[model samples]
Structures are given as C-alpha cells and as structure tokens.
Target chain A: MRGKYLLGILVILGALGYMVFGGLGRNLVYFLTPSEYLQDQARYQNRSVRLGGLVKPGTVQYDKDRLELRFVLTDGVAEVPVLHKGTPPGMFKEGQGVVVEGRFQEGVFQGTNLLVKHSEAYQAPKEGWTPEEVRKLIEEAQ
Target chain B: MLKTQTPSRPDALTWVFLGLGLLLLPLGLYLALAAPPDVNQGYLVRIMYLHVPTAWVGYLAFFVTFLYSLLYLFRQDPRHDRVALASAEIGLVFMGLALVTGMLWARPTWGVYWTWEPRLTTTAILFAVYLGYFLLRGAIEDPELRRKAAAAVGVLGFLNVPISYMSVKWWRSLHQTQSIDLTTGRIHMDPAMLQALLFNLLVFTLLYLGFTRFRAMVAALEEAKEEA
Candidate 1:
C-alpha cells in the first residue's frame, strides 16, 4: 500500500512539475510591448493581445462627453496608437506606464481594457503642498 | 511511532500568541489608517497593510507545512502529519485573503479586479495546488495511505509558492514589484508606511502561529475520536 501510494504521488508530482516549469516561456511574456508586437504584426492582427508601454506625453486626446480616449503607446523604439472607451482609471495619465488589452485593427489598437502599471516607489506628498502643486509634481516626475 | 504524541490541547504559548495578536490587531489597523498617504495612490495604499501580511503568512504557513511533511515522511509520525495538515489549511485561508484583497486593490488602481497576468495566474495555481492537497487527503480511506499521500502533496505543492512570489519580477506583469524587495533587502516605501506594514506583519505572524497550534490540537482530537 505504501509503495503504491508513493508511485501515485510521483506520477502526480511529475505531471504538475511539467505543467509549472515547462510552460515558463509562455507565462513569462504576460504582455507584449509595442516593439515586440510591431516586429510580427500579422501574427497578432486577428487575435486579442495585451500591449504594454508608456502613454506618450503629447499624444493624449480624451473626449469626456463620449468617454473616448485616444493616445499613442510607445516603447521608445516603436509606437502604437490606442483607442479605449470609458473613463480612464484614476492613476491613468500621460507619460504613465500602462497595459491595454485588445486587437490590432488597421494601424490602431482598439483597447477593451486599460490598466495602469505603477512602480514600487511609494512617496508621501510633501508637507503643506497644495493639491495643485501635488498634481504638478506628479506630472513633472513622469 | 518514536516521536512524542500530538498534544491534545492548546498550550500556554498558543494562548499567548493568540492573545497578543488579537490585542495588537486594532492597534495595527490604527497605524495603517494613520500612516501617511501615498503621493500617487493616496489612501488606496492602506490595502497593502492587509494584503502583504496575509500573503506573507500564506508563504510562511506553506513553508512550515513543507518542513513538517518532510519530517513525517522520514519519521513515520502522526504528529508531524497533523501539523502539516493544520498549516496547509491555514495557508489556504490566508492565501485566499491575499487574493481577495489584491483584487479589491486592483479594481480601482489597475481598472480591473483580476487579470491573467503572470503573478495572478501563478498565485491562482498555487491556491489550486493546495486545494488539491486537501482533496487528495480526503480521497484515501486508510489512515496511513492518506497521511503519506497528503505529506507528498504538502511537500511538492510548495514549489508554487516561490514561483508565484517571483512571477512579477521574472515577467513584465502589470502587478508592481515588491516595495520591500526581499532579494536585495532594500525598501522603496516611506518610513511611516513601512512602520505600519511591519506592525501589521508582526500581528499577523503571531495570529498565524496561534492558529496553527490550535488547529493542530483540534486535528489530534479528531484523530483520537476516529480511532475510538
């Protein structure tokens, strides 16, 4: 009985070990950058893909009435224009790192979802700073 | 058979841990609330007080299970098996808390409650593996076979813990990197926030210790009843 149980354990562990480690490469690329996607545009044209990069500073165009946001996402080497509908997240801003999920249509990426990619750094606002000043500091830092 | 029998009741140290942790929990919350807001996320950052500690306990509990599972295999002792079972159960609960809190934090910050990012996917897998551990335990009828199978699971399933923890760094996931990087021992958080996070961690650790001991005692009682 003990030997039988041991064999069962070995089989299960082997299968799980393969599932976890063997798929490492695919899992490692959770999202692709603009540069990566641009390199092989035809492969991702029809399928839904997640594109990650920085929101270009001067390319943001938002229509609050229509809840439409348009911007150029860049990876310093390549850029992809993105169009997302709905209110942008609180942390979403120009020059911020972001990941958007959707498919490429023509040249623009039609984003179904947008996510802000924050950094690990955590700093408190400087003492006695006005809200306006704080906003300025945030944009300036970006 | 050679190891000491499992204690049938909670010990003094167990009570002490429970008491101190419960007593300190409110204070920990207070510190989290009072901690200076983040320049970026503002009050939203307070969620880390609960999220980080719960995840830490989940990792710690699984590590304890892994250690005890090995001991059970070598010594053929029921006591180690019971401890391993209790720790894995608690680890699952704490890991669930971590996932829930993370989702809540993500909804407003990341614009979604959940995503199929590397870190999230790996954590979900880790949770499932432990759930499988319990299922494996329940499927076997003979006490010896059950313990042996569960111990094997407890040992092997823990591999996902490290994988889950490192997924964010190993992959370019949407999840932020660790503020307190365990690898480099460098902190990127403000001092006030750090103090609050550390205090919460201490309280949660104490609670986990107490809960594991208490649960192990209960497991011993259940085994005794089964034998009778």
Candidate 2:
C-alpha cells in the first residue's frame, strides 16, 4: 500500500514539475532592455510589454500642471523615447534604472506604469552630506 | 494492539529558546532603528530589518521540513513526520510575513505593491506548494499512507525555495539581487545595517526553534488523543 501511494505521488509531482519549470521558463524574461525591444520592434508593437533601461540624463521633462512626463530610456547601446501621463514615482530620477510597462504607438513608447529598479548596494550617506547631495552623487555614479 | 504513548511536554531547552528569543526581540528592533538610513532610499530602507530575517526564517524552516521529511521516509518514524509538519506550519507564516513586508517596501520604491516578476512569481508558487502539503496531509484517511504521501510532497515541494532565492539572478528581475549573496559570500550592505540585520536574523532563528519544538509537542498530543 505504501509503495503504491509513493508511486502515485511521484507521478503527480513529476507532472507538476514539468508545468512549473518547463512551461513557465519561456515567459521568464521579466523585462526587456531598449536594445532587445528595438531589435524586434514588430514582435512587440501594439502589444503591452515592459522595457527596462536607464533614464537618459537631461531628457526628463515633467509638466506638473499637466501631469505629463517624457524621458528617453537608454541601455547604453540603444535608446527609446517614453511618454507617461501621470506623476512619476518618488524614486524616479534621471540616470537611474527603470522599467516602463506600455505599448508602442508610432515611434514613442506610451507608458502605463513606471517602476524604479534599485541597486543591491545599501550605503549610508557620506558624512555631512545632505540628502539632495546624496541623490546627486548616486545619479552621477550611473 | 499496542498501547499509545503519552504526549510529552516541552523540556528545559525549549523554554530557554523561547525566553531568549522573546528577550532579544526588542534589542533587534532597537538595532534596526539605530541603523543609519540608506544613501538613496533614506529611512525607507529600514524595512529590510524585518523583511530579510522573516524571509530567511521561511527558507530555514522549509529546509528543516525537507530534512525531517527525508528522515521520516527512511526511518518510518511518526515523530519525524510531526516535526516536518510543525516546521512547515511555521515556515508558511514566516513566508507570508516576507511577502507582506516586501509588498509594503515595494510600493514607494518600485511604484507598485506587486508585479509579475520572477522572484515574486516563484515565491508565490513556493507558498502554494506548502499549502498543498497541508492539504495532502489532511486528505488521507490512512495514517501510514498519509505520512508517506505528505512526506513525498514535503521532499519535492522544497525545490521551489532555491528557485525563488536564485530567481533574481537567473532571470532579468525588477527585484533587487541579494544584499548578502549566499553563493559568493559577498555582502553589499553598510556595516551598521548588516549588524542590525544579522541580529534580527538571530532572533528570528531562535523563535523558529522554539515555535517548532512547541508545535511538534502539540502535534504529538493530538496524535496520542486520536490513537487513544
């Protein structure tokens, strides 16, 4: 009886293992870089996709009255223009890693959601440096 | 038929662990508050103190369940099965804590409370697998058959823990990579923050030990009652 039960469980588990690791593996690419998206524009055009890249410096244009934000996202090799119609996240800043979820319309990416990807490193601000200075230092490092 | 054994009470060591953990929890919280704010996230980064240790406890508890499940299979011991169940119960709670705390942290930083990222997906799956373990345990009417099947689930389900831990690295994930990388033994955290995190981890570990022992004792009593 025990052997029979074990065999039954092993069969069930084997099927579950295939579904989880095999079927889900293909869709595991969480986000695509600008380079990756541009390489296959036809495949992603009109379809909702997340584009991960750095916000290009000097390209962040935010109109507080209109709640419209525009920026150029770059992967150092390629760049994509993004237009978002909402207040940017507090962490959103120039030269920082970000993932924008939206569909491509014309030549620009229409962003529906914006997410900041923080680095793994967690350091205390340098002694006597203000928060604004610390922010600038981090952006400069990018 | 053989007589059933009486349920045993927690011994002195169990009390020591529980007392120590309860005593040290405040110290851990103090250390976390005293830890310096991050260069970028400012005081918002203090959430790591609760999030990391709870997640660590979840991983450690599941690993314990995996080990005890293997032991139960080899020795056909009911005691081992009880321990596995106890550990898994504690693991599920801690894993839920990790998930909740992570979402709270993600909102201000990532701009959303949740996403379909790899790390989050795999962790959700891991949590489901353990829930299934308990369901499997409850469904079986035959004691031996139930033990064997639940043992199988406990052994197989733990595969998700490592997958979840490594998901950030194996795939392009929005979730940040490990601050303290286990595979490379490298830490990317400030010394003060690291100390506070480590202290919390210790406190949680002690609590886990005590909780599991106490829970297993209760399981034994319940089993004794059922048998009698």
Candidate 3:
C-alpha cells in the first residue's frame, strides 16, 4: 500500500514541475501586432514570430508567374511589408485578414506561407428567381 | 488458509531517489542556463534542453499508463486501476508541458505559435485524445466499466504518439525534425551545450520518477477510501 502511495505522489509532482520550470515553461506563446513589431524593431530584428492582421489596401502585387508575391500587413497603426515566394491562396486579397509566417529580415516580413481568413456571411438568392429574373426583380423593386 | 506477509515499504530506496533528485536540480540548472549558447542557433537552442526532455518523459508517463492499464484489465485489481489512472493524469500534464514548450520554441524558431502541419496537428490531436480520456472517465458512474473503457482508450490513443513523432519525416512540413539521431550518435551542438542537455535530461528523468511515485501514493489512498 505504501509503495503505491509513493508512486502516486511522485507522478503528480513530476508533472507539475515539468510544466512550471521545464523548457516548455520558458517558451510560452504570445502574439505580436504589426505596430508592436515596428515599435520593437531593434529587439525583434532577426527573431521569428507570427505577425497577424489585415492586408493593407492596394499593397498586393503579384508577379505574372504567380510565384513571387508582395503585400503589406497592417494593424491599422502601422504596416509591414510581406514577400512570399509561393502561390497565394485563392481567397487571399487586399483588405483581407491574413497571418504570415517567417522571420523579419532586411526591413521585410518574408512569408513562407500565407493563411487567408474566410468570410462567414452567406447571401441567398431570391426564392423562385432565375439569374435574369433576379436582375429584373431588382430593377422592378428599385 | 495461510495469510501472506505484507511487503515492507522501501524507506531507504525512497530516500535514495529523493536525494538523487535534489542533487540533479543544480546540475540541470547549470546545463540549462550556465552553458554557452550554440554557435549556430544561439540561445534559442536552449529551449531544446527543456522541451525534448519533457517530451521524453511525457512518453514515459503514458507508457506506464498503458502497462498498468493492461494489468488492471487482466488482473481485475482495483490497485492496478488506480495506478493506471494516476499515470494517465501525469501523462496529460507532461503532454501539456510539451505542447506549451513546443509553441514557445516555435515562436522564436519557426516564427509561429500554431500551424496545421502534420506534427503540430497530430500532437494537438494526441493532447485532445487524452483530454477526452479524462472526460470519458467523468461521464461513467460504474467503477468497473470506467476502468475497462478508459483502458481501451488509453491503449488506442497511444498509437498516435509514434505518429506524432515521425510525421515530420513522413510528410513535408515547416516543423523541424528531431535534433538528435541515435544511430549516428552525432549531436549538431557544441560540447558544452550537449553536456547541458544531457544533464538536464537526467535531472528531469529523476524528477519524473520521484513525481510518479508520489502521485501513485495519493492514488492508492484515494482507492482505499473508495473501498472502505
């Protein structure tokens, strides 16, 4: 009985200690905005971290090959330039929310991957209406 | 009918284990912090000292659970069931530590806290599966059924552990593969940093043994109360 009891206590304490002081404890996750990235430029110079926010309007520039792409990520206060050497997601566009993954290098946010936030709202076509009928009904309603 | 003699508690062994743990703390601290940074990755490499060991111990804890869970099912002893439950709980805690540390390490190394890559996704799934193990235990009222059901799930859930570890090599992903290769016996690290990691691993393993023993004791007491 005593043997079992000792085992139980050991397991619990071990788990707690591993979480609190272990290497895992030191590297807990935190998010950074574009403004914070800019404000702490010197501090974050070469460190890798996630930068999340909306894509700045009119900042997206895509090469004809669709492989090399450029855009600006913004948190409303500041904008950071993003360069990706991959195909952008179909849903990726200007003014959309996006998160880029890569290190900050030479004043650019080089993204190896891009994740585009999809809109949730859904609009239904009018009941019993064809494409032409829908146009005619909109004109009649106006 | 003759009564069997009760096994004596190994007080000396317990003291020895505790002493070893105390000695390990200073050595682990030195290796984790006092050691110089790597010439390549710099200080961020230090995270490996903690993350890797936590991951190793998490697997060890779960393996204990799997073994004890089988014992409970086959022997139908409540003592075995208690030990299995205690191990599972400890395993969950270590798994959480591994995930948290992995995220922290990722922030500086991989540049993101979360990703849908194979290893990350599978690890998240492993965490959720164990979490579901606890929830399943809570949902059941019958002690015998709870033990059997949880044991089955425990065995099945462990199947993902290897998958999580190997996903990086199996598929292309942004997540970095393992740092150490046992067959090659070559560590891509400075000698001092390697020493630190090895020291920390020993300390964490000792710490793990001590904690597991303590938790098992508490579980035994709880079982005795239930039986009484």
Candidate 4:
C-alpha cells in the first residue's frame, strides 16, 4: 500500500512537471527592449519577440481606411519601426509606451499585437501641455 | 450554576462570521456590478472584483495548506493534517469560482471562453493539481498513509501558484498583465475601482477565515469520535 501510494504521487507529479516546465519552455519568448533585440540582431532574427518602447513622437502614421498603423518605437537609446495591421486603439498615440509582439522582418517589427506594457494611467490625454509650453515651464523651473 | 456549556456547540462568533459572509454576498454583487465601467474595458471590467479576489484568496488558501502540510510532516500531528485538508477544500472552492468568473470575463474580452494563452492554461493546470490532491487523499484508507500522501501533494501542488501568476509575463498571453505591482507594492487601478476590489477582497477574506475555522472544528470533532 505504501509503495502504491508513492507510485501514485510520482505519476501525478511527473505529469504536472511536464506541463509546467515543458509547456513554458516551448511557448515563452524572452521579453526584450528595442536595444536588447538590436544588440543581438542575428540571434533574435525571425523569432517571436515582445519589444517594448515608447511610441516616438511624429513618426505615427495611420491609414484609417486600411486599418494599418506604422510607427517608430524608441527606448531613448534605440528605435525600431513597427507595422501593425489593426486600427489604432483609442489610447494609442505618440509618446505613450507600448509593447509590440511580432517577428523582426527586413529591419521592421511586424507587430501582431500592441499592448500598453503597464497600467494605463493616462486614460485621457492632458489638454493643456504642448512642446513649447512644456519647454518654457521646464526652463522656468530650472 | 455548575451546569457547563455543551462541548458540541460552537461559540456565537463562528455563527456570526458565517452569517455576515452570507449577508454580504448580495452587497458584494451590487458593488461589483454598480461601479463605474472602466475607461477601456467597460462593463467587462466589473468581473475583476470577484475574479481577482478569488484568484488571490485562492492562492492564499493554498499557501495556508502548504504551511500546515510542512508542519504536519515535521510534527507528525493529525491536527495539522486536518487543517491542511480544510484549507485545501476552501482553496478548491475559490479556485473553481475564479475559473468560472475568468471564463465569463474572457469570452467578451478575448472572443473565447477558453484559450491556450499562458495564464489561462496555467490556471487550469493549477486546478487539476489540487483536485489530484483530493483524489489521492480519498484513495488511501489507512489514516497514516492518507495523511502522508495528501501532505506530499499539498506541498508539491503549491509550486504551481507562482507559475500561474507569472505566466502572463513569461510568455505571450492575451490576458492583461498584473495591475498590482508586487515589487514596488503599488496598485495600478483607478482609486474607485481599487476601493471596490479591496472592499470585496476584505469581505471575502473574512468569509474564508470564518468558514475555515468552522470546518477545522468539525474535523476535530470527527477525530474525537474516532478516538472514542
């Protein structure tokens, strides 16, 4: 009876171990910054990657008819072009940080999905601030 | 004056804990459904009040089982075994609730009730592992062997909790990433939503504590009967 119980325990644990480690190993893609993926370009090429960065200002171009969005994602130090085949989400805009999951192609991140990488505290864009106004405020504070 | 209270009867507080929980259920539902819709998620977000707490409290209950199981192993006490079983039962109940609520939430948001998405799949696996613990416990008739086998499972099954939580980060999943940051220990929801979620969390937690206490007392009575 003791031996039988031990065997039963082993069978269940074995099956579970396979599911946890094995399933995770096969499906997981190393989440990376644009700079990290750029650093090891060859190794990460043609592989699924979750690239996170800010949406660079003025690089956002959307075609409403085609439901296509093209933008440059920048991490201050590095930038990658992203092309996504979907209507821009309501909160999606320049200067917001986002994570794009896709494969690298011909120097572009062909994004399959765009997710705000963190809590979307910026529900509505602030109304007053602009480039020049922000610059003047910062200069005065300085 | 010498007549004493009956040993079979539990104190008033136990009943009070249970009554409060039962009474609060409707209020919890009202608060959950009546809260303002989220900016992005809309009405679908109301599920968070129930789903999030169920998952969190389920993990906490399993953690209790793990603690008692470890103690049982070291101390060789039947009391610890009883506590572990009681905790697992409640944990299973909440886990089932989380799964159902999760499915209901997922269908409208993700376009499917079930997905191979890492977090959803991992949560399913967690449910299976704990259910296996109960099955193992039933299979063994010898109380000594039963406690030992069940304890072993209670310890091993806990390894799934962290994996279930981290799957959203470790792999590609449609599920939203964690809103409550554990490292910095800050919640990332709007203050109103946070309040509703926390309120329900507190009510559910007290309910869980009270329910488990009553369950453990019943187990003690059963053990006493076997000895008698």
* Candidate 3 residue-wise lDDT, B45-78, digit = tens: 5677788888888877778878888888789876
In model 4, the clashing pairs are: none
Better of 3 and 4 by TM-score: 4
lDDT of 2 by residue, B151-196 (tens): 8989998999999999999999999999999999999999989999
Pairs of residues clashing in candidate 1: none
Look at candidate 4 and tell me the lDDT of residue A60: 92
Clashes of 2: 0
Interface RMSD, per-candidate values to 1 decimal: 4.6, 4.8, 20.8, 8.7
Candidate 3 on A4-87: residue-level lDDT in tens? Answer: 534554554465355435523332332367988878878877877667788898888989676888999999998889998886
Choose the strongest candidate by TM-score: 2
Candidate 1's C-alpha runs over 4 A off are A1-27, A128-142, B1-8
Question: How do the residues A42-74 of candidate 4 rate in per-residue lDDT, one tens digit apiece?
Answer: 887778877877899999998889988999999
Runs in model 3 lying further than 4 Å from the true structure:
A1-142, B1-15, B182-186
Q: Is the docking of candidate 4 incorrect, acceptable, medium or high quality?
A: incorrect
Q: Scoring each candidate complex against the real one, what DockQ results? A: 0.42, 0.41, 0.02, 0.11
Lowest lDDT sum, 10 consecutive residues, model 4 chain A, at A117-126
In order, the B-chain TM-scores come to 0.97, 0.97, 0.88, 0.90
- What CAPRI class is candidate 3? incorrect
TM-scores vs. true structure, each candidate? 0.90, 0.91, 0.60, 0.70
lDDT of 1 by residue, A25-108 (tens): 455687899999988987877999889999999999989999999999999999999999888888898889999999988778
After TM-score superposition, the amount by which residue B198's alpha carbon in candidate 2 deviates from its true location, in angstroms, is 0.3
Q: On DockQ, who's better, 2 or 3? A: 2
* Quality of candidate 4 docking, DockQ: 0.11
User: lDDT (CA) for every model shown?
Assistant: 0.88, 0.89, 0.68, 0.76
